[model samples]
Target: MLDARREDLGRMLRAWRMARDPGLLPGPVPFRGHRSYLTQLDMALLLGVSERWYRALERGEDRTYAREMIAGVVRILDLSPRQATALYRGTGHQPPRHRAGGARPDAALLDLLHQQRRVSWICDQAWDVVAANTVAARHCPWLMHPETNTMTWAFSAEARYQLREWDTKWAVPLLGQLRLAWQRWPDNERLDEVVRTVRREPGVAELWEDTTGVRGDADDAARPMYFPLVAPDPLDVRVATYGRFGDTALRWVVLSPVDPSVVFP
Candidate 1:
């Protein structure tokens, strides 16, 4: 049964790694076009570990795989947050279900959460906000504060606190990313519900019809905009966001200030 599970996991990793294109990685695109296949050695190099060590990993040997090492493999394979979490479990370190208090967030992740000090949250592979700090609660106010999903917050009026710029140019690409997520995970019921909710919310319906594509790049005209704090005067909270996707399904997002002066003390 154990070997069978290992083989199954190995197969999953292989499939996810194969599906990605060269454009997804850093450095210039390889010459002679590009190849889809990746050897165990290639994966090892991508993870910055020894070939022998990774070989053992592929064979399903337990042998102390560091969280970062496993995380690196997850990123290389481009696993969704859910997939990454599953893969993490398949390693045999994590439990299948939570204990009474539930699993604790890793120390590094917790540190990252506290550092942002803004309205930030982490989205699991299933597109659910698995973890969110108080700032996110204040800004988003889960109690009927417009749209629930991050995309909705980017496009809806309740999202007004997040959007300083008032143009479709800014809203369209973000919408497109959400659209891509819809295409990527049709089975994600939460995302499906979010789509339905946003679709009915006043102005969002119009933007959904005319989405261009995901546009968070530096060159995009929809640059960073500051959402003013209704409570305080002269404090413009300019949010700068960052994202890191694992080879597995998880994606971590950090929202912070464009400048130190904009942060709310």
Candidate 2:
């Protein structure tokens, strides 16, 4: 039974690797002379493990594998939540809870965001912007940037200028949300990077350490917030968030105009 499971895992990993688009993966595009699929060496390097060890695992020779290594594989391969859970169980490690999150968003969620009449965006548990609708892109152009992350944006000098109530309302509550996510996904490297980046900002480190159990009330109260647009107009928008269906760790954030008469630019 153990051998069978290992073989199954090996096959599945190979299939996933083959199916992945090279352009979407990190590192150089022509990875090790293979444009379509990743070699064992490439996978090993990405996962920070030895090529021989990775090959051994693929051959079902390494029965004892670390959970962190498995997690790294999941991240590097961009595996779905379901696939990650299955890999964990097949390798004799207890799978993490369904909502263990990451940067990737589901296709259905992206489609929904695009179809929404109101401005909507999707983010991962780490608060990385995954997708945004046309209205959101038009109003908040920064959201369309390739490197935008919620925590990074909040602590930025640009945010200090654009966001109303940067210190009290924006930064404080955002830090609280980060804290809550940190508690839930302690080992998430992306979240770790966000925390590190936020701490470097002036006065943010103190707030992060001193503030305990701060959670965002946007979803609970459906409160409206003000966002300053580049066009010298401030929009009052109510925020609503939804979790992705199933065990995925993706969330959808929708912004509706508080005043019906106000039209988005």
Candidate 3:
């Protein structure tokens, strides 16, 4: 029983309002407030409408408003074109166009991956494997190791054994991270294709459907690894992940030695 218009408006308000910094917005600045101009009274004055009427519109009690009025409010709020359009659409007014973030992978990002000696890999908003060093490629070979990076391999076949841990503990956190990426890049075509391919794996599909968040319960037990090490295994490793923000994002995960004494897998 959520009102779509109210929800959309709330989302937009939250999104826009959170971006404002007190240092950036003018005024004597209340000690804690972020300085948003969209107070209920201000909204009423801007709309040239009664405070009660405006309150009703904000509370989802009113379903319609004048196009010009909505546009004026949109301008007063200083919304981006897309944000304004979303507001207009939510209010049953004609929206100009739909636009979403269009960020891409960067080749320069490989430098960041290469600098680290630990097991490392990079994935975009869709969890597309953009880059991976030799260490990550060696151990977690099932999904990311192949010529074509596929998420399906994580849940199927030998991965249950390959992960160095029992049960879905290893796979679940990875899937959760990928799920976060999917939420951000819902329209990525490659991601859609990857999701379709992963669905064929029953285990992956089940985990994907389960909404519970993944926690690293097995983190302590399952050490960072590279399967079948050479004779002089030099280090004890632990898995740690890092993220880099792009115009969109790319999750750059690096698995490193918790202590030097621990040997390679």
Per-residue CA lDDT of model 2 for 4-44, tens digit only, reads: 77787888888887787644542222244547767888777
Q: Whole-model Cα lDDT per candidate? A: 0.55, 0.69, 0.54
**Which clashing pairs does model 2 show?**
none
lDDT of 3 by residue, 1-265 (tens): 5587686676655556445432332111224454643465655664567777766656555456777667555534446677777777777888743323323334455556655565677655555454565455455543233123435555556555445442344566666655666666777766666667766765666766774576433334344333565333323455565555434555665666666554334
What's the C-alpha lDDT at position 188 in model 2? 83
How well does each candidate superpose onto the true structure, as a TM-score?
A: 0.46, 0.57, 0.46
Question: lDDT order of candidates, best first?
Answer: 2, 1, 3
Per-residue lDDT tens digits for candidate 1, residues 127-178, read: 3344455466555544112113365555567555445554544566566666
**Candidate 2 error regions (>4 Å):** 1-103, 220-233, 246-248
Q: Lowest-scoring 10 consecutive residues by lDDT in candidate 2?
A: 23-32
Regions of candidate 3 where Cα sits further than 4 Å from its true position? 1-108, 137-147, 209-226, 230-238, 263-265
The superposed Cα distance between candidate 3 and the true structure at residue 244, in angstroms, equals: 3.2
